[model samples]
Target: MAITSANQLELLQTAEAVAREKMIDPGLVVEAMEESLARAAKSRYGAEMDIRVSIDRKTGRATFTRVRTVVEEDELENYQAEMTVEQAKQYLSEPKVGDVYTEEVPPVELGRIAAQSAKQVILQKVREAERDRQYEEFKDRAGTIINAVVKREEYGNLIVDVGAGEAILRRNDKIGRESYRPGDRIRCYIKDVRREVRGPQIFLSRTAPEFMSALFKMEVPEIYEGIIEIKAVARDPGSRAKIAVISYDNSIDPVGACVGMRGSRVQAVVNELQGEKIDIIPWNEDLPTFLVNALQPAEVTKVVLDEDAERIEVVVPEEQLSLAIGRRGQNVRLASQLTRLDIDIMTEEEESKRRQAEFEERTKLFMDTLDLDEFFAQLLVAEGFTNLEEVAYVDQDELLVIDGVDEDTAGELQARARDHLEALNKAALDRARELGAEESLISFPGLSPQMIEALAKDGVKTLEDFATCADWELAGGWTTMNGERVKDDGILEPFDMSLEEAQNLVMTARVALGWVDPDELARAEAEAAEGDAAAQEAEA
Candidate 1:
């Protein structure tokens, strides 16, 4: 109860034992005891008085003190804690305001209620220290795999003991309903380590693609030693997975290294993942070449990639269609994920039909706009002319390359195409006016008549509306919703407007309407350029 010589050393001994058991610093436990004793002293010596406590680390001695501060007369509120400078003369010769005065005080005998309160305070502090230690230990361990013993299962989620703390493996994070009972040792990827109100939560996942990468790294010494790098991983969980690997040394084949001698390395990883099938493919810098490899076991005839859209079209043989698509579209889906591109697969016959359809459509457009015969239109389409604008604006030399096309015929073709385009422009302007397109937007410097008509039809009729639009809203974008990428069609996207062009047009509109200052815009752009340069330098 009291600070007697008999039990003075008991305090330090208890702090050491608790700190050792909790795997925390003994200083933290001592600090908690100091705070708990201070609270007890405050209860014993009037609650209004300021009480403090300090414990000696060596001798386990407790020192109690009462502290009061000298203050101005008007600021003197607590008589026991704060005092007027004039009244402080009894304690010191020339006490000035803002000075603290302390006197030794006797340690209090703890009542049953006070002892219980002190115990609770120490327990709370110890718990907080333990949580901090756990978070510090596991925070950097995220993104790596760990072997843990299953502690229990809650609502289909597994709680595993991970040496220092417990980690949760969510039901969705497990591999294809693979269940584990208590005391079962499981390997999982530490997906995240987060500190919360309750404690630090370590989220583990066996279904994460990184888990497969880690497994390969463990099974293949080439990967662990950095001779081979895992470039990408896509998983169908317990069913199948694809990993792309690249070797830094020319002598080593990354895929062969991962497969090991007679399939020993890959078999080890597959067994750990509940018999998940893995396709090890070589990584390539060329995305199209890599994609052909990713959709492996299925031979591709041709690959047409649209870099701007991050989409690729693969033409395969009719016999390979089913193999490329796989059951439930899993093969193509994994290939898409591995390449980070949206893939559209078609048989060679389907691709030929598509090409024929496009050719007929373009030939028809030339016939209608250029007033040419079907044979002449077919000749134009065969010469790589897809639109009337190419005919109207192309050099005469380009048209002369066509067979049986002389100078006079080329002139006639261009004249008719120009006349038709002018008529179309006039009709678009008239339609825009009918739809309430303002002159402020119509007379804008960069927008064409067709662009104005499109904007008017989409309710972006005024200059103010155009100025308020975002670049992506006008140029279209891909958005990730729930995991899959969804396309957003833009008003100006049909005109093939790029995001940068949309941004420039919108900024020009803002400047013309007195919304943006040109000088400030220049300064901001300069600062942005400087920031980019600095970042590039740092990265280099």
Candidate 2:
């Protein structure tokens, strides 16, 4: 209706200036303002009228354009409509059927409604533009560390001012033993960034596994140069962590390099993690050995591995079990994560028991075929001779050197030992007959009658017969005669006494069992009597 005051013109320029500052498309701002003006115009001044608003950048003034659709003569209530083409053609040269004309509407008709609508539209456009800008700036920073200032702490979460905007550092992501005050300079890992209604929201973390890796890269020069690679890292946050490092150059010690001078490098990393203990261990190509090292501070005696199963059984002393497993199983748990292997730790006692059981099984097999005393059996055991070949390999001097043995005695022991050893390979029943063992030997205390019976039936009839039995098949079972008895007792002990007291018994049984061959016992006795007579004759 009239020229507006300076304030009205300033409002138009303010919108333009904000649009420029935000780098929004100029057309978008114009569209927003026009929509706002139209809403206000329709509500304030009746819907019958048309309204258009424009801002003159050069003149800084407001202008409006109002138009009406061309309709037929009967459309009298169409306050925003004009005459049809046929009527307009009488006053003008070229008028189409639907031709409409425009006229300027006064600004007074817009009133307060248009102003409010215009303001809302401009604000909406600005917010959308800001969100787009923030997204573009932050999306590329994922997985990288960013330096920021601590704005403040809200409910134990750090609100970091990462230049572009505030990023959230959740309580769990905050290092356990570290604190930062407002305006403190800090570093955080960019876990994620997402565009939200307010702006680009960033998620930052201080306790991430990658954070430890990044710290190592900064502290260890070898890591930065790529000579040593961190294969994997597992952390217990504030308390402890395990890092598996490998050297591409074998000459360079991966563990030593990561540890640095007196652990200065790792210590630095630990300090940064707020005193979390860090273990820098060499990563082994062999998973079993690698896992052994991973569960450190615990000494491993043996590593039994199941390659196809991807499992490792590590045996350690009972004293080291707690250390290897760590408090609350932290050490082994971290090792599992680092090596990706299922790890089992056993104590020395366990492995020892297993080995002892195995040794007993072999001894039982040898004892199954021959009747022998415990002392004689143990003498063979003391020589580390578990089987016949071991016995055959021993020399006379070696046999004599066995405790409680002399040269002549060693000779006898060797002869009897070999006789017993060779008989294990005989057919089971023949072996039993050779050793003078019967179904009765199986029924003795501490002897497995069923096992002895099985051995006898299998043609392993004597202690020697049992020795050659496969260790797998030599397992002793319970019997009604003797519960959980050893197979060795049933097979090896046929004589009632020692070599001294049992000489006559040995002689007799050897004859009865066919062990001395036909009448050789009597012939040996006669030969001994003759030798004694000749010695007496010589003395006279």
Candidate 3:
């Protein structure tokens, strides 16, 4: 084949046809053809020679040129493509470094080998351009739903053609081993669109909680219009799911709107999910109230939440225990996921037994340490005094309010509690020292003696060790590993150390050790305060 006068426009026609077929820019296809022609020219002339190709966009006329650049003697490396300024002077009136000289050349005839190579190059470039076009079209479409045609199954993953391109629905992403035949039309949530080496990989999912939310948004007008917002979703894939929604308009009930008129809207979503049971719960600002809603179909007798620990305990009647936990713990697991909290569920009798055990333990602690009788300790516990610290630091008026307690008795109780707490602190400090805690860490302002002991046991025995710690390392936090949240137990977590508190202590240690500038800290604090004030003003 050759770029003959009769067939010159063939290149333009082919480029336009390929671009239209692949849905890519026609110019990109033309550029790919030019590059392929240039490579063929290089193979014919000489590999080291400078050869370039350009095609007229409108006329499809191909131009071939042999070019050389003038460079300094020391920089001239490619003998065929580059020449020194002195040598370049022969070709021009005044030659200068970095000047390029080009001359028209005869187009070469294509051989069997060269034509095959050019075809491969054009195909590769077209594939890349197609991938880029597909990615640009779908990148912003992630987290939304799209209609697709089932193309084929590869290793249990569905390769569905989504009009412009193909996306993968992994085996795990399919709900309940769902199978589809070729040419079957399906809808899927665009979980992610990533640019990979071979091409842009579009990951589709039906099991993601967001997939259900997307379905609801599509089915319910209120949700689509932003009148109702789906705040949280938890799915057992094909089995069951829980959704929490809130409505901005008081006239519209979020749950009722999501459920639709006689469940028409939710039923559409349910059909898509293979009849997965959905519990549309109204979102509550109160976490415990929301939890009660999340654990639906089971009457909750009580909900005790530990906000600091991000955990909640629910008490139910004996008959509801099995229902609340669901078949194989599915209900509770989805509820936990929906609430973003760890949950502990028990029957009311179990809760009562646990509460009695805690009361007995506290009573025993007071009896042994404060040197009080069982009856007095029970009275203190009944009045909500749980530990020696609370009793020691509480006002004398609080003690006087208890039955059979007056000024003298209150004073005696405070004195005993303070003495016992002091003794416990001393023992903890001594144990910390034995565990190799330095004076600097022991004297750290924010840490208690028990906290110091805990740190010492964990090898954070020095101020330097404490300063090098991350806030999350000192205050427990959750980590998502392999799609599950795992707790990272902190050394000082048991002492009720928050991340903020840990940060303050670490910064203080750094300042004391001359590692941080006090003036800089003050400036930073002032700047932060100013920024907060500005943000507040903007909000107002």
Writing each residue's lDDT as its tens digit, candidate 3 over 418-468 gives 898888899999999999999989888888899999899989989999999
Q: Cα deviation of 26 in candidate 1 (Å)? A: 1.0
Segments of candidate 2 deviating more than 4 angstroms: 1-113, 197-199, 220-227, 249-253, 260-264, 307-310, 354-540
**Rank by TM-score (best first):** 1, 3, 2
RMSD of each: 2.0, 23.9, 2.3
lDDT of each: 0.94, 0.70, 0.92
Best by TM-score: 1
Which 10 consecutive residues of model 1 have the lowest summed lDDT? 1-10
lDDT of 2 by residue, 73-182 (tens): 67645655466756677655787656767777766544465566667887887777767766787899887888999998999999988875679999999877789999
Sorted on lDDT, best first, the list reads 1, 3, 2
Candidate 1: give its CA RMSD in angstroms. Answer: 2.0
| lDDT-better candidate, 1 vs 3 | 1
